[model samples]
Each structure stands twice: as structure tokens, then as C-alpha cells.
Target: MTLNRQWLLKARPHGMIGPDNFEYTETPIPQIGDGEVLVKNQYLSFDPTQRNWMVDRPGYLPPVGIGEVMRAGSVAEVVESKHPDFKPGEQVQTTGCWQDFAVVAPGQGPMGVNKLPPGVSPEMMLSILGITGMTAYFGLLDHGQPEDGETVLVSGAAGATGSVVGQIAKLKGCRTIGIAGGEKKCAWLTDVAKFDGAIDYKSEDVSERIGALCPNKWDIFFDNVAGPILEAALNHLNLYSRVVMCGGIANYNNIEPVPGPNNLMNIVTNRGRMQGFIILDYLPRAMEAIEALVGWVSAGDIVYEVDIQEGFDNIPSTLQRLYTGENFGKQLLRI
Candidate 1:
């Protein structure tokens, strides 16, 4: 019998998640019931949203209760199947938790297990073609609504979603500015991702730089790292600007209540629209976004990067990179 190694949530995180928050153990691989399939997990996705799932609170999906498998999206190859819908040798994507194997059932909806398309590598499906890409695509186009020659600014700009948002804005004929930490990330944004400007938020004065770079103010602000950066962007929103509220990695680990942006009055003053979105809300239209993204990637109109960590043992420490800004591009684990 295959031994399944799993990470169980041992305690709710008090601040930043630590090794003590999770307990790893080995057990027999789960047997598939009548409609279930057994998947051998190969890649585990590390996302900022997983932090929210760790807290015991209501979210788009219910929080992972204590002692449950640490919830995560993963790509797996089906090794055994009792379900008619799944076949052996097929690769699938699902919330496989932090484990070597997963037992999955279909019809979970929005967040269900499904077969990966042919020719799409596991890394591509998890990064640019997966939830990360979809979030950037729909959030920027549907909500940001950037126009030709308009200035679009994105926080967490070197990350998986934010990077894509900047590129998509550029493709739409908008001038793009990316806000990221460190000179290296900023350079990657302007030099590699091809954004019009890149701000090193860690080293430079963000509001002052925004004032200088975008004298007309930003037409769209796709905010992923919410904190001071959100406030800074809010202070410079142009008339009818749209703010797409994505992940808030800066505040995800805060034990104490964080304050709202003091400059939110700019939203009222400029008649700007700020909206938060859960990507699951756009699931029905995911195929539309996927087709466009695939086409863009195919034609060299879009590019992406992935940071792959090697060991399953490093999952906890790897996740902390999201909060610490140590991770560049889309963070993933090769199990």
C-alpha cells in the first residue's frame, strides 16, 4: 500500500505561519469510493489566498478547520480510478492539500477537480494558464476597464497575477506602471515584463514617484499588496479610475486589525470605483479568459515566470516567502 504523507493544520496562525502551525504525518493512501479517483500529486501551488484559508473565518470558501489537510491547489496524475469520468495516466488539477496523494470527486464546482488539457504543462496550468492568470485577466479587463493611453498601476507587480495585469494593460494600449519590492523585481518589471515604469516600493517613496511618473494620475489601480501602497495609489486616482482589489499579501499575516486607507476620500473626490473580487465569481467565464491568455502567450504578447521550490518538506517555509517578498514570480513546489 502507498503511504500518503500529509500536512495537517496543527494550530491557527497567530501572526506569520510557522512550522508549529502544521503537523506532518504518514498514512495509507485513501481508497477511492464508487465515484472517486486516486491522484499522485506532483506540483503544489503556493498562493497568498491560502493564508486567508488558514484563519478561522468565513471567506469565499470555508476556512480549513484545525487538523484538516492544509488546503492548496495541485496538479496530479491519476494512478487509480473508480470514477467513470477519470482515467488512469490523465493529469488533473484540484485542491489536493499538502500531500503526496489525493482522493478526489467531481462536481465540486468552481473549485473542483478536473482533467488538465492536452499539451499544457503542469507549471503552465498552475501559473499563467491557471487561477493566477484568470484572476489577472478578468479583474483587470472586466473591473479595471483601462483604455488607450490611460495609465495603469499595479501593486505586487512582479508577482504572478500582478505581472500579468500589467502586461494585459500594456496590451490594451495603456501605459503601465508596476510597484514591486527591491531593484531586481523592479528591473524585471520594466526590463523583462515590459511595463512602462517600475517602482521599488521598498526603496523609493511610492507616492512621490507616482506623482512624478504619472502627473495625470493613474486611470486604473490593480492593487494586490494592500497597505501603504493602496493608500499611495488611492491618493493619485484620476477621475473615473477603477481600483481592482486583489490579494492583500502585506496584511495577510497581521494579528492585529489593520487600518483602512486614510486617502480613500480620493475615491469619492475623483468618482473612482474600487471593487474587490473573488476569482470564483468569474468561474463561469473562465474559458473566455483562458482562450485569450493562451492566444496572447502563443503570439508572444504575454510572458510569465515561475519560482519552483524543490522539496515537500519546504512547503511551510516556502509559503512564508509570499509574506516576506522573498518569492519572485509564481511560487510553486515540485513534490
Candidate 2:
């Protein structure tokens, strides 16, 4: 009785992605079997990781095969259900892909479908309360291990995850410094997120700016941009400092092998630690982070932004925004 519009990956990308990489199709809405719930997706979460999913590579999760539906996370409402745990009208989160609807089955592979909390809007759920928030929470607290009065540096600081990481660092009493691409975003970091300092990477010499701002050396380096930014931070690490390798968006689309950070020896010189983490590892304790984040949001200690693009037709083009650095915060497609 319904139609489902879907986007299928038509080809693997060599450089920047475009509409030609996908095949759009429409079919009857999927019917739910026993132990399954039919979801009418409300909001589609656009994340940089979705790019990796499109490639054929060895990674944390298997790559989406050719001609397969592109994978993505979304917030949805159960319109029909046969599962005991889910009921009609309940809002849930699942890997709804680039589609108008999804059939969520129980024990859905890692990041299984789950019910959302009460009273929180879908925007908040997809932004600060969802995977982006959890990534920031765990990446900073559990991995970075920031200390009070210490200096914390965050690359890609105006992004969804980076913004939250900077705020959490500030709330922990650390001096937070953000590295962004332009004057407006840098200003937002300093003026709005209240970062102790912001460096406009597009205009300033990263190494020089960081050397001046963190004269005492940095205690925690949240490396999201990686590459040259990671190298710049490496040149200024304090003894026993912690580096949280959250992401490397700078080279996610690179076809040729990108070289490692040039200042790799700094870790040994400063006797500091550098480690990477995948948020999926902390799924068992996600609610703890979610509750703390919720409390922070409720108390006005933490704030976030969402850059929403309308229509499912724009998913491919909209995703390119993350690569071009055109998206302001959490990028979401309003379905």
C-alpha cells in the first residue's frame, strides 16, 4: 500500500562522489515479518564514515557491496510491528540506509535498533544524543583522559563531534583550543562554544599559531583532521600527553596512499601516548554517555548545531559537503 524510494550504489568512487555513482529506484514498501518492525524514517544521519562504507576495503565494518543500498543511521517511528519489544508509534534508531522506510529485525547487527528516549526531539537524538555525541564523549573522556587546568587541542573543532569534544573538555576545566578552516567557524568556536582559543587553519600557520597559544605544551590532542594537523600538534606535545585519534577526515577520500604524520617521533621524544578508538566498541555502555550528555544538555552546559538538508534526493550531493567542509555541524537529511 506504500512506495519506497531507495538509492543503490551503482559504482565505487575514484574521487569525489556524484549522482552518477548511485542508482535510484522505487518499489512497494517492505512488509514486516514476525519479530520485525516496519519503520517510517523521519531523519537520516549523514556521517563521514558513510564514505568508507562505500569503498571495498578492510575496516571495522564490511564495505557495502556494489548494487547494495548505501548504509546510514536514521531516526524512525514504528508504523507497524510484530516484535514484542517494539510497538506502533515508538521512535527508534537503526541503520535505515538511504531509503524512505526500513524493516528492522531484532538483534540487527552492531548498533542494533533501539528505542529513543522520551521528550527529546529527533534533531537532538540524531546530533548530540546519538552516535556523534557518544563518539565525542568516549573519545575525550575514556581515551583522551583530559585533566583539569590542562590544555586540550581539538582539530576539526567546528564539526559535530569536534564541537562536542571541545565543550566537554571545557566543562572538565581544561583550556580548550579549536582548529577550524575559516574566520566565521573559528569565531563560533571562541564566541559560541567558548573555546579558550581558535586557530583559523585556512589563514594562519598551524604550527606557529599552536606554538604561541600552547606555549606550555598541550596536554591532550584530539586529532580529527589528522595529516598535517596531527603533525603540527605532534611538534608540541607535553610529557605524558594523550592523543585521541578520533578521525582523519582530511584524507578519507584519498585514492593514493596518504603518508603518516611527519612528526611521529614526537611521541617517543615526549613519552606521550597516541591511540585510536572506534565508537562501536563502547556500545555496551552507550546509555551512560547518553545520560551524561542528556544531563549536560538539560543544564545548558553543552550545546550543539545541526545543518539539515531537505529531501532524500539530495543524499549523495549532501554527503559531499562533509568532504568539501561545507557542512557547519552535524549533517542530516530531513526525510
Candidate 3:
């Protein structure tokens, strides 16, 4: 019945976010109008995308305005409603961003979480059915364009999106090789996720390991962490290869500007095509992809991982984990 407590963005950050960047205060609960509903926030999504908002810059999405709650996807329950579309007891996954609660117009944005299948955890719907899964589905199949008997390479291969990319590549009959940050993550990719092979950038040489993994040269590259790794993949692409430009996790925290890839010429030399997508453009086909992903996951053909931290207050710290590659899978904040 009482509404309040919000974390507001006080100032933008220069590099790594600090506690002073946010100001926690009590706010009023807005009254729902004839077509609106009040939602009680339950979980918040912590993603690499938040880093883009730290600075006042232009990108695929607009930066979060100062004094607004940090922008994020959230799962909440509708506690009060005046709209016919939503009921009080229904739980929906809404954009809570960083606030504890929100007042939103009914039947807008993402899907409603009011109803869920029993035995299905929030991690499944939130991480796998949420944005991360969509990124993998559209980014891999539509952008990467895997072909039969081809070799596919994925950066940040242990991540939620990257992991899904590798599996989809395998399902398409491609040899999936993963490039992860550490030995532990690489082990998870090869052993748990059943990737064809794994590369540890921290210990092994990328060029040498990639050579051994796919001596024929990579045919499809699903890149999540760009920077040098992307250049490496470019240098090794097979003729007429497809390079899917997904997320650039590596560039999320650089204080200085990043230089262009040195091996970009490989695209010309190999006669390859490199394309980037934001997933939003393909939202109309998302449900069809979700259905396929669900079937794959349920059939043991696809594997997913989720690293969830409890509490709404942990959102800032949990998000920081994404930059460090400390999170092995999809990062989520529990409310």
C-alpha cells in the first residue's frame, strides 16, 4: 500500500561506477489511472548494456538521463491495477530499471510475467527467455549465418549469449569453438556446454589455439567481446565467411578511445561479410526463436547458465561483475 524508496542517478561515471554515482531516496507511489497499473518489483537485470549509459554519449540506445532510475529490465508483480488488461495478482516481467516499483501503462513492453509454467524458474524465463536469449537467437542464426560442416567461433563463449551461439552453431552441424577469458570458463564451455573446443585467452595463444581447433579456418564468427579478439577472428575467417557483430564487452570500460581492428583487411582479402545487429530490429520474430530455443533446451541439445545475485541494492555491484568476466552466464539481480 505504501510506495517509496528509489535509487536515482546522481551523476554519470568516468570509468568504473562508484557508490556516489547513485542517490537512494524515498519517493511517492504514483496512482494508476484508468489504463495503468502499479507493479511491485521483484528482480532486476544486470547487463553489460548498462555501462554504455555511464557516459553521456550516443550509441544504439539513448543514455539514461540523470536523476532517473538506472535503466534495466525487471520482473515485477502487479499489486494494484485500474486497467482491464492486467490483474492485481498477475506477475509480469516489466522494465523496472533500478526502481523498487513502477507505474506503467498496461500491455506495453516485453511480455507480461503474470503467468508462468510450474517447474520453470525465474532464471529460465528471465535470462533464457529474456533479452539475453533473444540476443543469442537473432544474433547467431540471423546474423552469424552458420552453414553445414562449417567452423564457428564465439568470443566470450561462456556467457549466456555466447554459449547459446555455440550450441546453435552445433545444431546447424558446425564445429563450435569457444574463446573464453579463463581456464575455468573454458572448461565449462567444453565440458558442460559441450562446445567442440575451447580457447583460454588468459593462458593460451589465441592464434595457435584457434588454428588447432579449426585448421580449416573459421566459417562463422559470433563475436560478443570485440576489440583484439574480433581482429583475430577476422584474420582467420574462411573465404566467404560471415562475421556477426553482436556485443563488444571488451570496450565497455575503456577510459580512452579504442582503435580500429588491425586485421579488418582480412574481410576484404577473404571476401567475407561482417554484419552487426541490435536484436530490436528483429523483435517481431522473437517468439518463434524463443519457441525453438525452448525446444532445444528441453531436448538437451542446448545448454544455458545464469549467475543471479540477490537483492535490488546489489544491482550496481552485480553489473560490475559483467565487465570483469566474473559472471559465467547471464547476470541477474534478485529483488
* Candidate 1 residue-wise lDDT, 1-335, digit = tens: 66899998999999988788999999888888898888999999999999999998888888888988898999999999989989999999887889998888886634678788778899998999888999999999999987999999999999999999999999999999999999999999998899999999999999999988898899999999989999988878899999999978889989997998998888888998989999988877878988999899999999899999988899888888888989999999999
Cα RMSD for candidates in order: 1.0, 1.0, 1.9
Task: List runs of model 1 lying over 4 Å from the truth.
Answer: none
lDDT of each: 0.90, 0.90, 0.81
Candidate 3 overall Cα lDDT vs. reference?
Answer: 0.81
Clashing pairs in 3: 72-97, 91-113, 91-114, 92-113, 93-113
In TM-score terms, candidate 3 sits at 0.94
Q: How many clashing pairs does model 1 include?
A: 0
Write one digit per residue (lDDT tens) for candidate 2, span 112-156.
Answer: 898988888889988998888999999999999988999999999
The residue-by-residue lDDT of candidate 3 on 17-57, one tens digit each, is 76777877777886777887888877777777778866788
What is the C-alpha RMSD, rounded to one decimal, of candidate 2? 1.0
lDDT at 240 for candidate 3? Answer: 93
Model 2 lDDT vs. the true structure?
Answer: 0.90
lDDT of 2 at 20: 84
